[model samples]
Target: MDVLLVEDDKWLGQAIEIGLTERDFQITWVRSGAAAIGELQRQEYQLLILDLGLPDIDGQRVLQSVRRKQLALPVMILTARDETDQVVQALDSGADDYVTKPFDLNELAARLRALYRRRGGHASAEIQVGSLRLNVNSHEVWVADDPVRLSRREFDLLQLLVSQQRRVFSREQLERQLHHDETPLESNALEVHIHNLRKKLKHKDWIETIRGIGYRFSCD
Candidate 1:
C-alpha cells in the first residue's frame, strides 16, 4: 500500500522513510504540508504519516481539508506536541492515532499495520484464508491445523498475499512489498516463494494463478 509521509525535519524524514521502506511499505516523503495536500488532491494513499510541525502549513489544516473532501483516509500524526489539549484536538480533527516524538520504527510499523487492518475490514490480529491461518501479532502461520515454520521473508510474503484474498498482485507489486532497498529480488523471487508455499501447503487448492496477471488466493 502507498503511504504519504509528511515530515519537515530532513534527517528524521530520511530515517523514517528508510525504516518504513525496510518494512515493505511504499512511502512518498514530502517536507511541507502544501506538497502533501497537493499530492492527496491528485493521487490516492492507504495511510498518512503526518507531522504537526510542517513548514508551510499546519498538519491539522491538511487533515481538515482532506475530511472536507469526504475522503476518510486513515491518518496517524507524529509530533512532539503531546499535551492533553493538543492530543484531544487532533483526534477530534480526524487523526486515527498519534505517536509522540522519539518513537520506535517497529512500533510505528505495527501501528500502521493495525490501522490498515481495522480500515480494511479485518480488525483482528489473526487473519485466515482457506485452510491457512496467520497471527499478525505473534508472527505465526498455520497450515491445515499444523504449525508451519517459515523464514521471515517467506512469512512476510505470505502475509501480504493472504491478507487480501482473491486479489491479483503483479510481480512488481510483490517485489515492492517484499524488497528492501536495492536488495535484488532475482526477478523470479515471487515464483520461488509461491512454489515453496504451494509445496508446503500440499493442498490441492490454496492459491490460484492468473494466466497473465498475477496470483490470487482461492476464493472458492
Candidate 2:
C-alpha cells in the first residue's frame, strides 16, 4: 500500500520507514505537515500516518484539512501522546485509528492492513475477483488454484486494479499508485509492470490497454 508518513523526528521517521518498507509498504516520508498536505493533494495514497508533533503546523490542523477536502483516505494517528482527551479529539477529527509511540512494528503493520481493507469495503483480507484470488494480509496471489509469485510493485498494481475491477485507470493514476516521490522510475516502468502482470497471470486480455487513454482490469 502507498502510505504517507508525516513525522518530524528524523530517527523515528527513518526507523518507521525502514520497518514498513521491509513489510512491503510503499512509504513516502515527510517531516512537516505542509509537505504531507501537499503530497496528499498531488498523489493518491491508501493510508496516512500522521504524528501530532510537527515543526510547521499541528498535525490536527492537517487532519482537519484532509477531512475538509472530503478525501476518503484512511488516516492513522501516530504520536507520543496517549491522553484520553487527545485520543478522543483525534478520532473526532476523523482519524480511523490511533497508535502511540513505542509501538510494535508488527502491530502497526497489521493495523494498517485492517484500515486498508475496511477502506476498500472488504470485510476480510482476501479479495477474489473471478479466478484470481489475492490475500491482502499475506500478500499472496493465485490464479485458479495455482500460486503466482509477484514482485512487490506487481502485487500492489494488481491489487489496485482488481479490487476496483472495470474502472479505467489513467497511466498517471496507476503510476502514482505504484511509485512515490523518493523513488525514481524509468519512463516505461509502468508498462513493464503491466506487461509482466499479464504474462504472469497467463491472460493477456485481463488487463486491457485503452490506446491513448490507459488500462483497466477487464474480466469480460
Candidate 3:
C-alpha cells in the first residue's frame, strides 16, 4: 500500500518512511502542508498521515480541503497535540483515526493495517474464500491445509479480488492499486501476474476472467 506522510520534522519523517517501508508499504514524504496537498492531488495513496503543525498551511486546512473535495482517502492524524478538542475537530473534519506523538512504530503499523482493511470493507485481518485462507497481517496464504507462497504483487492482487469477491475490477484499477509508481505498466504485466496466481492456486476456476471486462473472484 502507498502512504502520503505529511510531517515537517525531518527526523520523524525519515523514521516513519523507514519503518513503513520495512513493512511493505510505499511512503511518499512531504514536509509542508502545501506540498502534501499537491502530492495528494497528483497521486493515489492508500492512506494519509497528516500532522496538524505544518510550517506552511495548517494541517487542519489541508484535512478540511481534502474533505471538501470528497477525496475519501483514509487519514490518520499524527501530531504532538493531545488535546481533546483537537482530536474531536480532526475527527469531525473527516480524519479516520488519530495517533499522538511520540508514538510506537509497531502500533502505527497496526493502525495502518486496520485502516486499510476497513477501507477495503474487511471486518477482520483474515479473509476466507472456499478452502483458501489469507492472513492479511502475516502475509500468509493457505490452500486447504497446505501453505501457498505468492509474490508481493500476486498477493496484493488476490487480496483485492477476494476482499471484494465477485466484483469485476478493471485492469486499470488493479494496476493503480498494486503499482504506486506513475510509470505505465507493461501490457502483459497484469496478465502475467494473473496467470502466475492461477498456477500457484492450482485452481483455474478460482478466479474467472470476464472476457473483455477484466477479472473477478468468482464466488459462484
Candidate 4:
C-alpha cells in the first residue's frame, strides 16, 4: 500500500521508511507538515502517518485541514503524546488511530494494515476472489488450494488488483503503488511483474491488460 509518513525526527523517520519499505509498503516520507499536505494534494495514498512535532505546521492542524476539506484518507497519529485526552482529541480531529513514539514497527505496520482493510470495507486480512485467496497479514497467496510463491512486488500488485476486482488500474497507478518516490523504475518493470504474476498463478487471463488503458483482475 502507498503510505505518506510525516515525521520530523531524522532517525525515527529513516527507521520507519526503511522498515515499512522492507515490509512491502510504498512509503513517501516528508519532514514537514506543509510537504505532507502538498503531497496529499498531489498524489493518492492509502494511509497517512502523521507526527505531531513538525517544524512547520502542527500535525493536529494538518489533520483538521484534511477533514475540513472532506478528504476521507485514513490517518494514524504517531506522536510522543500518550495522554488519554490527546488521543481522544486526535481521534475527534479525524485520526483513525494513534500510536506513541516508542512503538514497535511490526505493530505499527499491522495497525496501518488494519486501517487500510477497514477503509477497503474488508473486515478480515484474507481476501478471496473465485478460487484465488490472499492473506494480507501473512503475505500469502493461494490458487486452487496450491500455495503460490510471489516476490514482494508481485504480491502487492496482485493484492491490489484482486481487492478491487474489475476496476481498471492504470499503469501509472500500479507503478506508484509498487514503488516509492526515490526508487528508480525501469520502463518495463511493471510489465515484468505482471508477466511473472501470470506465470506464477498459472492463469494468463486472471489479469487482463486493457491495451492502452491499464489492467484489471478478472476471474470470469
Over the full model, what C-alpha lDDT does candidate 3 score relative to the true structure? 0.90
Question: How high is the lDDT of residue 88 in model 2?
Answer: 100
Q: Taking the tens digit of each residue's C-alpha lDDT, what string does model 4 give over 1-220?
A: 9999999999999999999999999999999989998998899888999999799999999999878774678899999999999999999989999999899999999999989888767778888999999999889999999999998889999988997899999999999878965778899999999999999999999999999989999997
Q: What is the C-alpha lDDT of each candidate?
A: 0.86, 0.93, 0.90, 0.92
Model 3 — TM-score against the truth? 0.56
Q: 199 in model 3: Cα distance from truth in Å?
A: 48
The model with the greater lDDT, 1 or 3, is 3
TM-score for each predicted model, relative to the true structure: 0.57, 0.56, 0.56, 0.56
Q: Give candidate 4 regions above 4 Å deviation.
A: 124-220
Q: Any residue pairs clashing in model 2, and if so which?
A: none
Candidate number that wins on lDDT, 1 or 2: 2
Q: What digit string (tens of lDDT, one per residue) describes model 1 on residues 88-150?
A: 999999889999999999999999998988776768888887678899888898877899877
Weakest 10 consecutive residues, lDDT, candidate 3?
A: 176-185
The prediction achieving the highest lDDT against the true structure is: 2
Cα RMSD, model 2: 16.5
Better structure of 2 and 3 per lDDT: 2
What digit string (tens of lDDT, one per residue) describes model 3 on residues 73-165?
889999999999999998998999999999999999999999888876766888888899999988899988699999888899999999888
In model 2, the runs with Cα more than 4 Å from the true position are 125-220
After TM-score superposition, the amount by which residue 79's alpha carbon in candidate 4 deviates from its true location, in angstroms, is 0.3
> How far does residue 139 in candidate 1 sit from its true spot (Å)?
26
